[model samples]
Target chain A: MADLILLFFLLVCAVTAVAQRELLNSAIILSIYSLIMAVVWVRLGAVDVAITEASVGAGISTVLFIAVLTRVKRREEITRFRVQVLPLIVVLAVGAALIYGTLDMPDFGSAAAVSNTHVVPRYLEKGVEETGTDNYVAAILASYRGYDTLGETTVIFTAGLCVVLLIRSEKKRRL
Target chain B: MMDFILAKYNFWIYVIIMMIGFYAVIAKSNLIKKIIGLNIFQTSVFLLFISIGKVEGGTVPIYQGVEAVYINPLPHVLILTAIVVGVSITAVAFALVVNIYREYGTIEENAILEMSKTDD
Candidate 1:
């Protein structure tokens, strides 16, 4: 019951943030959105995901957003906040397609879910034995999925390197 | 009818939130606003994946050497990487936005368009 109400409030915060007049205000609301989203993940039995969301979504992202917001103009243009119809229609169509597609999916928390049946049991049974880690998610991430995590780390490194390059170039030009 | 709504309402709510983000990304004029929309859209997908990973009487996927159901661990691992990637992408995006503002002097879509037209 509480989870349902939280989801509803999440939707409201998300929409309100989108409609905010100031980019800074939107960023703040989005930070709140991320925080609530973390709680939602906890309710869904994903503690690791909840931690990641709280740190990445609510903490670091908000700081980065505000730092950038300070560098740019604070307020969004009011003259251009017009109701756009064609995009709304397009978004609605895509959403309808998604909803129709979900009718066939397994119900939430079904033990017989296909995802729960295959490959999952193997990981569950052998995960600790293979990786010497109690947390299967961590074991998979660090051992079974080592290459994927490395690639993601490299991607983050590349992104940071690119940002540094861009900022340095801008500064040199200014100098 | 109530049971149907209860059973399927999560999917519908996520879709609606996803659409709101989509609409903002397409319709908003401000670059920063678009970034926020992109974040919302990205996280909605995350929530959808998390919802799928739930189990009827499951605990978190920390093995305890005892009998218990555990939620799927794959999605959680995948989403952790994705969240990091999303942040890096946002960082690069904001850097680009800053450079765009320096080059063009405005982040509003229409203003940037007009500036480029004047440049041409």
Candidate 2:
């Protein structure tokens, strides 16, 4: 039941991505899409992932996109020039192969999944004891993957600097 | 029959909400309206998360020396941080929007494109 709803939502987001006309509009939709993906992550028992998605994906990225949009507002009218059937066929073939590789996988919610058998159980048990934090997700994100988070933060800072460089001019516009 | 009905109907309803948010984003040219759609989409995801975190008969996590079950606190804490992030992003986006309006004199994307083309 829930799976069907999630699948349907995914389809909707895809449609929204393609159908939007304005660049700014599309960017906004993209933010929304990111937000929805966060929820999906949480529903799938990936609360930590959801937090990152909501913050970085939906929040920070959206701001970056809008900043870029401010500089270049209008999208170049997309014209489908050539029939690129060969590329499409190749892409589809690769996608199908990937899907086929997962044929022997356990059911989605099965306890035997790698996520459960692997690091998750250990984290669930030892996370609080080791980190001494009530929120294990935060501990994992800030401690276990501290280097990755630092890298991500640096990337965000770089993006912000780039935006400032691009928009800044000899005669600064009054904000 | 109950499970069948739940599966058949509830799934589509969530889909429709998501699509509406997505469609609004894709269809509208107005920057603000698109943000609104984004909010809708973001909120829907929040709903999904909250729903998933919900355990039947679960009480609030706060304990007053009572032995009642509680819905997981993990999702709530995560959401609190997420909401702050969402607001910050919105603030930055709006700031840019203001800057765009200042420089371009118009927020409409098509018009700006046309203006840039002629200037070029």
Candidate 3:
């Protein structure tokens, strides 16, 4: 029941956020959207995801969006006479296709679901045995899937370097 | 009837949220707005994945007494990596947007296209 309300509120925030004309307002609304999403993740028993979402989705991304706003124009220009029908059609088609795809998915929370049966039990059974970590999620992430995590960390490193290079180029151009 | 709706309502709501972000990404003109739209879209995808991981009576994946059902922690780990990636990418994107503004003097998509056309 509570989850239902949170989902509805998320939908509302998502709509209001996208519909806002002012870029600052849109960014602010998106922050709220992330916060609510974090709560919903907690409600779903995903405590780690909730914490990460709260910090990253609400914390880092909002600041980045707002900081860039200072460099760019505050208000979005409302151009006229542009035919935007193509994007609308494309969005509608994609949404419909996604809805169609969801129809065959297993009912939520069924223990017999494919996602539950495939390799999950082994993780639950031998996860701590193999990795020696107390937390199953931690065991899988840092050990079973450590290589992927390494690549992800590298991606973050690359992005940071890229941002620094961009700033440096701007300074050189000014000189 | 109500049973079916109650079971899958979360998925349906997230689909709506996803579409809202999708529309903003496709239809919005401001570069900042487009980035914001992408943020919305990414978080919604996170919600969808986490929701799928829920077990009705599951607890957190952290060690508890044996024989307790913990929600699928796989999705949480994957999405954690994804959330970090999303944040870093957003930073890079913003840096790029700042550069674009400096070069073209406008952040609107149409205006940038016009500037490029004249330069070509």
Angstrom error at residue A130, model 2: 1.8
Is model 3 an incorrect, acceptable, medium or high docking prediction?
high
Q: In model 2, what are the clashing residue pairs, if there are any?
A: A20-B26
Summing lDDT over every window of 10 consecutive residues in candidate 3 chain A, give the lowest-scoring window. A75-84
Q: Tens digit of lDDT per residue, candidate 2, span B1-120?
A: 764444234333444454455654555545654555665566555544444444445443333233444444454444545555455455555556656666677666566677889988
- With candidate 3 superimposed using the best TM-score fit, by how many Å does residue A170's alpha carbon deviate from the native? 1.2
Model 1 bad stretches (over 4 Å): none
lDDT of 3 by residue, B3-80 (tens): 777777777776878888888888988888888788888887887888788887888898786798989988888999
Question: What is the C-alpha lDDT profile of model 2 across A1-93, one tens digit per residue?
Answer: 575666566556645554555677666767777777776765655565567677777877677667656565445343454434554455346
Any runs in candidate 2 off by more than 4 Å, and if so which? A81-83, A157-175, B1-120
List fnat per candidate, in order.
Answer: 0.85, 0.01, 0.81
Q: Lowest-scoring 10 consecutive residues by lDDT in candidate 2 chain A?
A: A101-110
| Deviation (Å) of A160 in candidate 1 | 0.7
Give the true-structure RMSD of model 1. Answer: 1.1
Best of the candidates, DockQ: 1
Query: Tens-digit lDDT track for model 1 on A78-110?
Result: 665569889988998999999999899888788
- How far residue B89's Cα lies from its native spot in candidate 2, in Å, is 15
Model 1, global lDDT: 0.90
Superposed on the true interface residues, model 3 gives a C-alpha RMSD in angstroms of: 1.1
Ranking by lDDT: 1, 3, 2
